[model samples]
Structure formats: structure tokens, C-alpha cells
Target: MLTENESIIRFFKELGLEVTSIDLGIASEQERSSTIQISRDSYPGVEPHLVTIADIARWFPELTSSGDIRLKQPQPDVSNCESLDIYRQYWEQLLSVTDIIMGFLKEYRTRFSRGEYPTTSWAHYFMNWTHETWDSRRLEPAPIDSWICYVDPSIRPHIRELNEFGLITRESCSGHPDDHPAREPFWPYVMFEERAYPGISAHLFTLADMACWIPTYGRHGFDVSLEIPRDVELTRGNIESYWNQLISSTRQLMPLLEDYISTSGVDFYTNMSNPSLFRMPANFQCKDMSTTGDFSR
Candidate 1:
């Protein structure tokens, strides 16, 4: 029986985002409604889209190791420049995930009456139901930790970017020989982490594996997941359907994204091959959608 405003407030509350104020300026006097605003502190910062390499090193100085070849300038003893291309990949992935979630919320609010929305609570939809869609294979939510965030091949370029900026990074093939490109796919990923010690590093460690932000994109559509009597099961169809929708949604939001980035002092780089792309401030890298391997540095 909660009002839509109340539901939104509750939803953000569970996620630990503080609500700063509710502006009623747009509401007619007789309507008695307002727009809710979240506190700016909830966002990481305007400086970098994600955490910076310098900050990561400062927080986790244990990145250097005894066996590491101490270079004159800052550099890791071993390097897999090829795998480093994925460093900034997470930014778009994160943003894409966020946009889709917002899209879900908007759809939910539009389709359901204030008090008759599905689900016991908004948090349930936000956390558990974001990824479930009909006519799609269920996507198992991956954990959002240093392994996925920093060490994953998708963000290797991001790590290398950090290293180029005087932040020391480490990489080990871990007995996987470098001569065989055929076995490269199965090689264990290098950990882009500080080696000062074992436990003191502030490596990337987001709980919920970013799953908390991904809503089920299955058959029910975004709004259906928010309503009562919703089906939680995955439907069989083109697994690419949800991803396609997400891509379409991202395309739709590009104008707003460009404006927001500009206002936030961020730069856009369409070419991942640009040598300076990573060194730039809060840069958004947009590679050709068809050519994923071209960005490998």
C-alpha cells in the first residue's frame, strides 16, 4: 500500500544511498507530489568514472613483491600487454547496467499504480530480479571483487593504464608459457593488485558482484519484474535478446550521457587505440561495437 514516492525512498534506503531532499517545485499545489533527490556522496566522485590507479595503489601498497624485477621507472617485471585491453571496459559495462536498471524502474512506475506494483519490495526487484527475462538464458550473476574488477581480462587495459601513470602493476602467467598463443585463452588471468602484503590492500571489492544493479532482463520486461505475481524463472529464446535491448537502451541514452559527461568534466574517446585515452581525465572509451579485438593493447 505504499505510495510510489515512499517505495522509491525505501528502495534507495536498502541500498544505503542517502536521500538528500524531495523537491516539490514541479508539482502542482493540489497534487502534493515531488521529485526525490539522492545525496551526491552516494556517487564515487566526479574525478574518475571509477577508482583511480593512484588511489588504488595508495590504498593497497602491497602490490610490489620480492621476486618482482624492480624497474628504474615504475613498471611490472612481467607483462601481458595483449590482455590489458579490458581496463576501461568496466566503465561502460557498469554504466550500461545502471542505465538498464533505471529503465526498469521507469517502466515499473509507468505500468503499475502506486500501491499495486508487484513484488514484496523494491529491493527485491533491484537485487534479485534484474537479470531474469523470458526468452533468454538466465545470466548467473558474477561476483564483483578484485578478481572480476581488476584482474579480469576485460579490464586489463585499465590496469596497464594505471601502471603507465606511475602506479606499479604486477602480472604473472602462473606457469602458463608465453610461447603458445593457442593456450592463451585458458591462461589464468594476472592480478592487477598491490603486493605490499596479503590483507592490507584496498583492491576492488564490491559485494553483489554488481548483480545488485542488474535486473532480470528476461521475458517479463523490466516492469513485469517489479509487479506482484511475477515469474522468476528464465525463459528460453535468443540469449542475446537482453543484451541487444541493453545496447539499444545505451544508444538511446547517449545524448544524456554526453551531456552528463561534459558537465562532469569527462572526455570521450572513440578509439581505444589512442595512446592517450587512458591517461586522460574521466575518459569514456567507445570502441566499434563489431571490433572487440581491435582495442587489444
Candidate 2:
């Protein structure tokens, strides 16, 4: 039988993620462990949280592509009143989704793990009886180019799962240790694209629900955002604890997202009107989640 440490490394190897570091947190040595943690250089910089109006213009050029309106990235001394108005409209759409998600998380907790605990290898649970986490990790879907460059192994599958609900992820970080010489803002977070799909209400609510149901939430709940990218920040400070929650939570999220699609409807953006779909807001509109291809000129 491969040791838990090796199991983790093998898991990442298959996922094509470069493991920068791995520390099998043993419950005996650490207050609570047995949850293996690893850090890969999958994501290079701090995930962008509060991007400027100019950033939105670049991200969703389709919205700014009228012959009358053009956007340029703001230089240090530049000010943009035109883009500012458009930015407000974008933010309003994003905030509408955030509000819906917040309400859902605040109202429910029964389906989530009430407290953080040491769980066995996910590879063992999800895979055949052979290697524990190794097998389980193999079953996870491969990451697309954009996601592979940013989303860490633990969080990548969930990103893919989000797509099943008609959501698009913009950026993600599995998180670094507090003492890793970085600011806290470089937290464990998953940022979603503020797609114009029914205005992102479904995406926001799903992420908020992810925070509540993700294992080990009893102590370390996520900090969901109200601004652009509309992310949820994991509340753990230590790297090991952070990865544990991220990876372990994913095991449940996969099936849950499927069940959500099966019960509510696979076309997530189209199903916003389904009150059972995270009890979406009354005025929520379900629209196509695709952006018109990058509008050049």
C-alpha cells in the first residue's frame, strides 16, 4: 500500500500539477490532521479580486463594443467617466447575484459538515479499493488551459463542476500558508466570471452554497464576495488546513452539482426561475451565459 504522502504526490502527478510542496498533516503531530496537503505552482500570482472598471472592459469587451463606446486600460494619471458608467452597470449585475447567494448561505447549513474533522484519503473513497487518494484523484476531470494555469489541483474539479451549472470561473487559488511571506489578501479563493447570464445570480448562489456545504465549514467558513469576480474566500489561515478543506470539500461538491442539475435542470442559466435552484431571487432572469467573442476594434 502506498503511504498517504506518496498517494498525494501521485495524485497530483496524474493531474499534471507540479507539486511545489507536500506535508502529510498527521493528526498526532498537528492538533488535527491525517488530511494531506500539497502546494503546486499551478497559479502564478495573487488571484485578482477587485479589478478596476478598465479590467472589466477587457474581460467583457462585448458589452463595451458599440461604435460610440470604446474602453482603454487606465494609466496612472488617467480618469474615465465613460467607462465608469458602464462599470457601474456591470457591478450592479454582479451585486444582484451576490445578494442572492448571501441570502441562501445565511438561511441553510443542514447539508454541510458542521465542524472540521480529519477525513481519510479521497482517493480511497472515490476510487477502487486500491491506492487511497491516488485513484480518487485520477477520476477528477482534467483542467482546461485557462484553468490549469491558475486553478490548483484541489480546486480545479470544483471549477469544472461549476460549469455544469452554467458558470464560468475567472481565477482561483488553493491558498498559501500565512507565514509564506505574502499578504493575507492572497487568500484561498475561487473567483467566478461575472457573466451576463441572467446576471450571474445562479453562479453567485452556487458558490455561496459551496461555502456552506464544503467540508470542514463548521469552523472555517468562506467569505463570499459582493464585487466583481464574485468569489468566495476560504477562511483558513494555515496552508494545510486550507488545502484540507478545499480538496475534501470537492469530493461532495461533484455529486451535489450533478444532483442539482438532475433535479433542477442542466441548463443552469436557463433555470434561474426554478425557485428550488438554491431558492433564486424572484426577479432573477435566466439568460444565455456566453459572451460574444472578444470584439476587436
Candidate 3:
């Protein structure tokens, strides 16, 4: 375990090779008050009670191991309303600050591994790119209700109707529909549905087999819009390299993730313990304090 300040410093030092001085400078400008405000916004009804680093260390002693702070009893004077309110405010503020700190840390780790500080937000950009790629790659309009299933010899008669309706196109070729000019057979529209019982024997179709049949009979030309960038192609050799970098960055940020999960867990447990935290219908039973009979015993 480490002190809050020590943890913060260690995070920066570990990523010093990838982080710019300007990044650190910008992060330092985040004020304690702003963090508190954000926390209040996050949990609307709950008042924050303690926000300082020392207070956090006292409450969550697992964060530090210099001494056993967890053994100390937290004695609050309930008579002083002002003191209680102040404490709540500080606690809320600390939550917000910690969130911001973790976010920055994740961003730094991702950017470092990627070898670029994305000008736009990386998450938003990735989502948009994926959507665009999907749109460009889709050759034909999708059916309203498409499903895949196995094709039994008995179901061939029913499938003929599907073929007549132009729902499925079949072809024969071994290469990708977009890249291979070979007349590969595939069936995109024909979906195989499974029978609930083995005795039912409904026709089963694997995705590859379905794809093989599509180009053989399907109506549209191949769509090559989802082509990868020349520099970013996912070749067999480079795919693992990309994954390795991602895993490394994630491992480095595990501590922050653990802290966030622990904090949230504490909040959830606290809320569950307080029956007054929720407003229930009069007829509803409060399960937390319920004395229901146990059938297992």
C-alpha cells in the first residue's frame, strides 16, 4: 500500500517515458473544488462528508500500508449537523477528483501504446470509424427478419420458396467476397433455425457454409468499402503486436481500475444497508430487514 500522493507520483513516473510535460501541466490545473462539484453531480442525493487525501487514507486504509489505519474507529459527532455536512461535502469532492485522475491515467496509457496522442477523443473516434466501415462494407439491404439455421433435406421444399423470393443468393468461391474475384459460392439470406429436440432434425447451417452458398446464387456485386488502411492492415504478424501493447497498457492501469471498483462497491454496500435510501410503495416488503421463512433449512 502507498500514500495517495505517493500513488499519484508513481503513476506519473511509470508513464514518464510516454507523457509530455505539457500533459502533466494541464492535469495539475484541475482544482479540488471542481472535483467535488463533479462528484455531487454524479450522486445527486448523497452529501459528501470527507474529501481530503488524509481523510481518504483514514477511510480506505487499504490504499496505504505505512501503519494500520483501518484499525482506528471512525467516531462522528452526530449532534453537530454542520460538521457532518462538511464531512459529506469533502467525501463527494474526493470521489470526483479520483475519477478525473483515473481517466487521465487511462488516456495516457492508451495513447502511449498507440504511439499517438489522438487529436479527437479516441473512444468516440473508434466508434465512428467502426460504424462507417460497417456501412461501407454492407453490399445489399438487410432483410427485416433474418435468421440462420440448418438446412435439412426435408426443408429443401420450404427453402425453394426463399430462393424464389430472392432472399438468398448462392455462389462458389473460396476467397473473401470483397477481395476474391473467384466465383465463390455463398448464401447470405438463407438462415438456419435449430430444432429444440434432436429428434426434430431441423436443417443446421454453419456461418461459413452459409457464406459459401451466398455468392453462388445471391444478387449483388461484392462491396469493397470496408478495406483496411495501408498502414493499419491487421496482418497475422502485427495483430499480436497490437494486442500485446494493449494488454501491457491495461495491466499498468489495473491498480486504478481496482481502486474505482472498490470505491463503487463501498458506495453500493452503504446504500443497500440504508433502507431510507430508497422510497418504496407501501405494500412492498423491505427485504433488507425482512424475517421471511427459510425453506432451505
Candidate 4:
């Protein structure tokens, strides 16, 4: 078995890539802090909590809702935004980081697969930053290309499972009517899928169609599917179960995902090391558990 560092190095070497000199210290620290925050929120008061947008909204309604009842409308639909320039800015920065990291992994994988010694710096950088932003919370939009590049193909099965469960919807990419360049190039020809849930749609894509549309554009010619859950009556119990199922599926796939990357010689780090980048965080972890399942259960 590969040590964590060795495994990372070997995985990248197998992809035939090189590492850059950028320090991942800040990113790693941010990720660790995010992890600790999530852990604390998840395990508060000796009980484990499920992480869902509704749960967070209930616990911190102030963050989500306006105080004046008259002024309150449904949450802003992130999908219908007339302009996403602000979101685009953040996304580009994140993608840049993913790119460098993945580039190194690709190079490392190329060397390793050929039975050659791997680059030491590449391995070290990966080990230091490997855990950074592994969870969904840190994953923002923008650097979606990196997410596609680094995500393990094994997760595709879970995506299919989610679709079967009515948690996601699969469609031809060309069917969507959105006209963004991101959406246009991949249309019609590529098969696509998307999440069916309203809450997750708002949180991740900031727009309802984003869970499906963004991937279509980012992946371009590749046939891809979106992974989202369907919105049912929001009850505490049902929401909890749905969240649990999704989280369980994601967690179960983590190891196999790493193995898949290693075996396939995919360069995850290089794809993620750049500053202007966006990609989905392929990993998921528990967060706050305060709300009863009724919020969406």
C-alpha cells in the first residue's frame, strides 16, 4: 500500500505531469479550519448532526432570511441571475489553484506508470494540500473544469444511483435552453443530468438549473450528468434520510475514488493548484445537526 504521500505522488506520476512551486499552505489551513468547523457543528452537544442547507438555515436563519416579514420573499434563485459576474470571479480563482495541483499529479502519474521515480516536491505538495477542500462546503463554482478533471469515475455509479432514487435528473445536454457559452457548446450532443432538489440547487449552483447546466458547459463535448436530489415535501425525517443517503454514498466512494485516480493516472493536484479555478468538491462530510428532519426530512 502506498503511504499517503507516496500514494499521492505515485498517482500523479502515473499521469505524466510536473509540480509547480506554489505554496499550498494557505489553502491547506483554510481547509483544515473548515473541516474543524464542520466537525464541531456536526458533533455539537454530543449528538451527530446531518449537514443540509435547510438545517443550516434553521440554525442561522439570520444568514439566510431577511428580518422583516414583509420584505421577505423566497430565497433568491441563484439560477435565474441576470448576471453572475461576481460568482464568476470567485470561481476563476479557485480553478487556478486546482489546475496547478492537477498538473503535478498528471506529470507524477506519467512517470510512475512508466516505472520511474516521482518528483519529490509534487508528492510533498499533494500531501500537504490533499485534504484541503475535500468536502462539499468548500467547493464553489467557477473552476468546474478542475472538478471534472479530478473527480474519480467511480463516483459516476453513485451519481447513477442518485438518479435512480429520483434525487437527480438525467437529460441530454442540448435540451437545456440556457444560452450561456458554457451551456451552448455542450448542448444537444452530450447526455447530461442534474440534481432535482431545490435547496442543494440554491446552495451550490446559486441557481436552480446550474446543477445541470454548468457541468454541460464546463465539460464541453464530454457527455456528463448532474447529481442532484429531487425536492419532496420538506419534513425533518425525510430530509435527514435523504441527506444521510447522499453523504453515505459519497463517503463510501472516497477510498475507491483515490484508488481509481491512482490506477487511472489522473492528475488531481495539477488540475486544482491554480488560483482562478472552480470545481466541485468530490468529497462530502457531516456538518451541523441542529434541525429536526422537518426542515426538509
Candidate 5:
């Protein structure tokens, strides 16, 4: 299925409209997604359709056009009180407005970070770049590669246990510590061997596939995102009780990871060739909690 943004861009082509992402790198999430430039593709002389939320909302106001106002959510006013539900809006109708509004907000934030807002009080604000770790979706240039690896003292036993289970351990961290070097992720993670393709390392990938079936991995709130080529650098996530989460997942899921030995029924990860598979989606690690280790997730 086409994503909302992709589908809109596709329709834009039919209508002789076009969208493209451009860089004016005062970093914002928009650079990773959303259309920055939209223009008329067929008519070279026509001006770009630099539409905004107010404009688009006007274009599609039939639902709001003298219809049941109760269908929409009301803007709050003060009795020092409550809100009246206007119209219970529809998803598809709102999505078009959402894309344009999101792009607008992205630019607004980027400009604010750049201190371009016209307000004296804003003069005090400056670009606040902090140390951030982007997700590692790569299998190469791993920081370490060895069967004998040093992990957090708490995670060491778990590591040894997994290694003995035949999932070759590559790298792991037990999340933030008091003396945290600041380079490591704030969440705990394990990097195990995965088959780049069917060969000696195939079992590792098979085990990884089995891990996907362990219901406890998610039910217990273990926010572990699994990226293929399983690089330790970036395919990481944050968690509460991170070590306990790691230990519990190992203890509870081991039997399950081990039981599914036969590859006959397995769905081996099929998109190992895509480079993006090696990297977690943007802001995935930045999230405080997330979904499972399935490469598809």
C-alpha cells in the first residue's frame, strides 16, 4: 500500500502537480519526509502552488460548509470551562490538511530554532544542538566484532545464555549508567548475528525470525526495534527498567526462540537488500518506547 504522502505525490503527477524535498538545513523532521517544494509540472510558466493550511481547508470545506457543526470539534473558549464537540471529522478528509499543516509547522519550528521569528523575547533563544545517536541499520563498520565481548555486568549472564542458545552475540549495552560515556544509547539492546543471505549465518536470522513470534517481547513492554544486518550503532531503542526488560525477554523468549528450529515454515526476512533496512526509521530511537525487533517493524 502507498503511504499517504506517496499516494498524494502520485495523484499530483496525474494532475500535473509535483512535490519534492529540498534542503535549507536548519534541521527539522520535514527533511526526512514531506514535500518542501510543490509546483506545476506541465505548465512551466505557472507559479508553484505554494498552498498553506488555511488555503487547502478553504478548498475542501464541503463538510464544514453549512453542515452539521456538531460533527467537528469545537475551538475552546473561556467560561473557564469546557468544549463543545463540533463535527466528528473523517480521517481521509483531514489527512490532506494534515500534510500541508505538518509541512508548515516543520518550517515554523526550523525557523524558530534559527531565531528568525520577529519577537524581541525570541532573541534569547539559540540553536541547541545536543549529542544525538542516529539509528545504525548497517552490518558493517560495527564498533566491535567478537564472540567474547564485554557487556554491562548485569547483561553479561544474559549474553552468555543467548550465545549458548546459538544466537551469536555481537554487541550490547545495558542502557544509561551514572558514568555513562554519553556516546551509548539510553536504551539497552542486543546485536546478534543474522544471515546476510542463506549460508552458515542463516540460523541466526532464523532465530531472529522466531524472536518475532515471542509475544512476551511486546506484551511486557520491551521496546526493541530490530534492524537487519543488525548493527549495534543505531538499531537501538529506549525503555523503562531496560535491564530487567532485556533479562526478562531473554529468559521468557529463549524457549520460544529455540523451539522454532525448523526453517520449513519460516518467513525469512525477504528485504535484506534494501539499505534502509539496515537503518531504523528516522526518530525511531529518539522515541521513548517503541514496537518489536521484527525487521518489518
Candidate 6:
């Protein structure tokens, strides 16, 4: 089934209405899911699923007329409280830092290509850049527990929605480790490694991270990490080429997440213990968390 956004855009085009834009960025995936849930509660037995653009428009008339949908959430007042935005902030910060580091790597790569041995300053410079970036509050490695809290009960459904698209969680943390002492310790986030690249291989596009945190005393949000592998040659051209490939593979995450929020009716409650089969929607395979490896709490 086409996602809510895709359906809306297609429907509007069919109606001869030029859709300038669909505002999925401002509203979070969880908020859309909440809105759909509200509609389900209000009109019992209408349909268990909300998959088409008309489904959303029928429930939210404003979107039909204005091409914008905003669902009021029972959330405390906070600036940029949307989970997607929070996630975007974190992802973009890391991307920006990645760009900066990649710039240096490019220079190093160029020198290496010319058969010049890298000076110790290259390593020192990389460390310095990391320190400066963290000091600026622009980028930092998020704790996994905080991410688990922010996504549970709301945001994670969208993550699971990715399963339908051939992406599954390789490993995850429910964030409450102490609850099950006999089981593996609770982790803070989820990791999708080589499995993220279905047909593709090589370290360049094999890793992604999803995490969340409380940016303020009361406000909570999410962030993502994409690991771009440094080529053996360590050349800037190679780094950029690989980076582009990584982006192309994972760029759909935000948009698809927004669409899932708007229309998905799935709430996956799979038991991770069963590695051989997943409870996810059809066409998606069950995850194997055993090979996902240990993560920082």
C-alpha cells in the first residue's frame, strides 16, 4: 500500500489540484499515529487501518483543503517538541560534523594519493575537530537509554514500519535493563548494521543508529547516527563517493517515517527472543538480535 503522503500527492494530482507541498516535517510520526488513533477511538468500526490520503483527509478535513495536517498532542509546552524535528536536529548536527571531518579526510586522502606520509597533525587535527564539535554543543554521542524512553509507546512504531521496506532492527534496547536481570542488560538504542544494506555490502553503507534524549529538563526527543566508513585509501574522493551512497540508501527514513505516522495502523509487539521469525508485516523478515553485538548504555 502506498504511504499516506504518497497517496495524498497522487490523489491531489489526479484531482488536477497542484500539491505545492505536504507538511510532514513539522508534525512528527508519533503525532500522526496519535491522530489516527484518536480517529479510531472517535469513529469505532470505521476501519482498523488508515492507509490512503483520503483516509487521512476524511479524518482530518483541514489537510484536504490546505494540504497541511497538524494534530494537537497532549504534550508539555516546549520549543520544537516534535520527535521528528528532534531527530532531525541530532542527525543534521552529526551530518554537519561529518562533513567537516570529511573535508579534512579529503585533504589527507589527496596527500596520501600523492604518496605523502600523513603527519601526526592529521590525527591531532581529527581529535581537535571532535573536541571542538562537542564543545560547541553541536554534536555528541547520545545515550541509548534516553532514546529508548523517547521512542517507546509512540515513535517506535514508525521504526518498525521500516520493516515493510526490507529494513529490520538488527538489535535494540528497551532501556529498562534491570527489569529482566536474567536477560541481556537493557540497551539504550537500536542498531542496524549490514542488514541495512540488502544487496549492497562493504562497510561504507552498513551502519545506522537511532537514539533519543531529553534535550531539556522536561523535553524529550530523538536523533540518528549514520556511520560512513573511511576507505582504506582514506581519500576524500572515495569518502565522499561512499558518503553519497550511504545517504541515498537511508535518506528515505524521514519521509517514509512521516508517511507511516500519517497512515500506518500497525503496532508491532514482537518478542525479540524469537530470532528466526518476526511478527512484522508481510515481506519483512524477522530480526536476529544475537549478532547485533553489545552497545553502550
Which candidate wins on TM-score?
2
Which regions of candidate 1 deviate over 4 angstroms?
A: 1-106, 114-232, 266-297
TM-score of 1: 0.21
lDDT digits (tens) for residues 1-297 of candidate 2: 997556646654554333344433222422221111222122110011111111222221101111111112221122443444454454344334323333333322222233221121111111122222211211222345645645555555555665445445555565544433455545445554432132232224333333432211111122123111113344444444444443443443334334232343234333333222122234433221123211010
Give, for candidate 4, the lowest lDDT window spanning 10 residues: 64-73
Q: What is the lDDT of residue 281 in candidate 4?
A: 31
lDDT of each: 0.27, 0.32, 0.26, 0.26, 0.31, 0.29
Instruction: Assess the local accuracy of residue 227 in candidate 6 as a C-alpha lDDT between 0 and 100.
Output: 28
User: What is the C-alpha RMSD, rounded to one decimal, of candidate 3?
Assistant: 22.2
Greater TM-score among 4 and 5 belongs to 5
- Model 2, which residues run further than 4 Å from truth? 1-143, 151-167, 177-185, 194-237, 259-297
lDDT of 5 by residue, 1-297 (tens): 986556656654544445452222213532221112343222221120121221233211101111100111112232322211211122233345545434323322343343332111100111011101112122332332354455665556666766555445556665545325656444455655432111112122222332321111211221222322222333224333333444444454334323233331222233322212112233322211112122222
Please report, as a residue range, the 10-residue window in candidate 5 with the lowest summed lDDT: 119-128
Alpha-carbon TM-score of each model against the true structure? 0.21, 0.28, 0.22, 0.19, 0.26, 0.19
Model 6: per-residue lDDT, tens digit, 16-53?
Answer: 23344454434543433222111221111111111122
Q: Which should have the higher lDDT, number 2 or number 5? A: 2
Candidates 4 and 6 compared: the better one by lDDT is 6
Best by lDDT: 2
- Order of all candidates by lDDT, from best down to worst? 2, 5, 6, 1, 4, 3
The local lDDT score (0 to 100) that residue 82 gets in candidate 5 is 21
Please give the distance, in angstroms, between residue 153's alpha carbon in candidate 1 and its true position after superposition: 14
